[model samples]
Target: MTAAEHLLAAKSFAELRGSYSGALFIIASGPSTKAFPLQRYADYPMLALNGSICCLAEAGIAPLFYLCDDSSFVRNRLPLLLQALAHAQHLALSPRVVGSLLAQEPQALDGRSAYRFERVNRLPEGGEAMSDRRFARQARKDPDFECDFSWFRQKPNRIGFSRNLDKGYFSSRTIPYAGIQLAYHLGFSRVFLVGVDLDSSLGRFYEQGEQAVKSRLDGDYEDYILPCFRLMAERVINPGFQVYNLSANSRLPAEVVPKIDLDQLDALLAAS
Candidate 1:
């Protein structure tokens, strides 16, 4: 599908409010997300990433939706995710990663009611009618013995999720792009990020499940994550809608308020 078609297919505020009307809960899959008192949030609709999905599942907190690119982290925790599918409202994913989730199907969600399994993009030409089993079977024939989908990258901004070559403003900035898209669709004036710890220890997302991944690019934090986020913050965040990082490990400077917590946000929301 085209970019417009992809964006149009995304859930909109009207449909969401018609169903779940409340704060647009942004659940980052960072290890620290496991720290939140999730039971306190049983009533809110949440969008969780891969590891956070695992943590959320273990905590008995059913998220409204799960989001993740085709990173290895996502692949490592498939069983946990497939388990949550039985309860989650939807599983929002990029196109490239669909293979991983599809391959695990048949068993991943057997006997469970059908939940929304949305692929961010349309299936490629000739990929139509390709059921989960058929796709997996084809992968079995690959000579390279590699059929994983963790290499899936988000499509360029406003260009849809399948066009791999077009780089819009937010193509490289995964977090903010998704946040903005979700905020617009959820009708939120502010997007608060909980557990957005970009610190990569061991070049992964957890330390014994509590650690962070490290980067060798000496200032990769600045060179990579920051520039992309800054660009997205400038181009995407609307005047009425703002994005704030609300994690204990958030490295965003004070210029970005609630950079540490929701104390101030709670007060503001309460007053409003």
Candidate 2:
């Protein structure tokens, strides 16, 4: 069966809609996230994306949800991903990723953790799917070209061709954007982002001393990363829901989303 078919047969996310009306912390793997006080927000619901799991584990912080969409991560770093899986209560992945793991090593999904599988559409209607390098060039010239996120406001279980360009819940260029959609699906009223520095030069905190993965930070940020934030500002943030950038040095503009320091976290939570 296709990933879309699997999503159709799986349990609906409606049961978790608005389940967590409190604050949510989304941990990105950016180097700035290393400064975040994990223990301070230990009780808060947290979602860790990709390599951020390494730092979270080192800090003895276990995220509630672990999210990833790239199949290459599974193909190249299966052991690390599995290690992170042990620390998360739930796992969210794309249907393509699920299929890849099941086909390569089905034991990876032997009911060790709860799963939320989403259909990922990299290409939207009326657009040609281009390479990353080419897409970035186009995005740099066209500010209007952005991934659509309207599907997130609808019921979660309804399955169809939910393009990332049309539905924010579907996979985008970055996993953190998908994490935001998951947080909203679970009914979080406020979302906080940490370690989303979007700086390629600084690299990832977990890979500071070790061999670092090659990154297209400059292009990807200008093209895909920044647009995701802009989309959130326009579509997701409202009286019903708000997203805050907690990384003080994050590249995201304050106009897109308010940036707050860790010291203000207590006050923010209290006000919430």
Per-residue lDDT value at 141 in model 1: 53
The sequence of per-residue lDDT tens digits that candidate 2 reaches over residues 1-272 is 44444444445455565667889999998877878888878888899888788777877878888887787778866766877767887777666677776766656655555455543324423456554444434443433233332223321211111212223253446677777777777778889999888788888787744567766778767555676677668855788788888877888899987899876777889988
Off by over 4 Å in 1: 1-22, 107-177, 202-224, 256-260
Which candidate has the top score in lDDT?
Answer: 2
In order, candidate lDDTs are 0.49, 0.68
Residue-level lDDT tens digits of model 1 in 1-272 = 33233333443333443233335567765556666666665665667755566666666777766665554544666655665565566655554444456554534433333322233323543446444344334433543111222123311122221111111112333443454455445456656676676655423333364344333333544554555455445544556656666676666554643474556657654654
Error of 1 at 102 (Å): 1.9
Q: List runs of model 2 lying over 4 Å from the truth.
A: 1-10, 119-170
The TM-scores of all predictions, comma-separated, are 0.62, 0.76
Residue 97 of model 2 has an lDDT of 70
